[model samples]
Target: MMNLKYQMIIQWSEDKSFLVGFPEFPGQTWRTHGDNYQEAVNNGIEALESLVIAYQTTGETLTKPTFNQAA
Candidate 1:
């Protein structure tokens, strides 16, 4: 299990579904989506896991997570 902390942005799309995206990983805007909010979160987590695994399997460097400091 990968315990990497990354950003997952979920927003309602015009298609009437929730879209998920990872800001840390560029190039692709939307990765996984869902019909509802909960589903979107679940799909986002799965997508994040797969992304990390893919990066590791390919011996590629994983992007550093952005830490937002509390003001």
Candidate 2:
């Protein structure tokens, strides 16, 4: 699990599902989603964890967050 916090954007799509996006990661516009908001958030977190692992395995530096997070 990654301790770093990245931005997760959850929005309602026309398909009537929650679309999840990671603005900090440079890849697909929408990473993962779900039928509901909670599901979307859970999926997004899992996707983010996988993404972090992928970057680490590839020895690629992650992009800096666009916004600062409050402690």
Query: Best TM-score goes to which candidate?
Result: 1
Q: 20-68 in candidate 1: lDDT tens per residue?
A: 9999997648999999999999999999999988899999998899999
- lDDT scores for all predictions? 0.92, 0.89
User: Residue 17 in candidate 2 has what lDDT?
Assistant: 99
TM per candidate comes to 0.93, 0.87
The residue ranges of model 1 lying beyond 4 angstroms of the native Cα positions read none
Off by more than 4 A, model 2: 69-71
Encode model 2's per-residue lDDT on 1-71: one tens digit a residue. 56767899999999999999998887758999999999998899899899888898999998877777599
lDDT of 2 at 31: 97
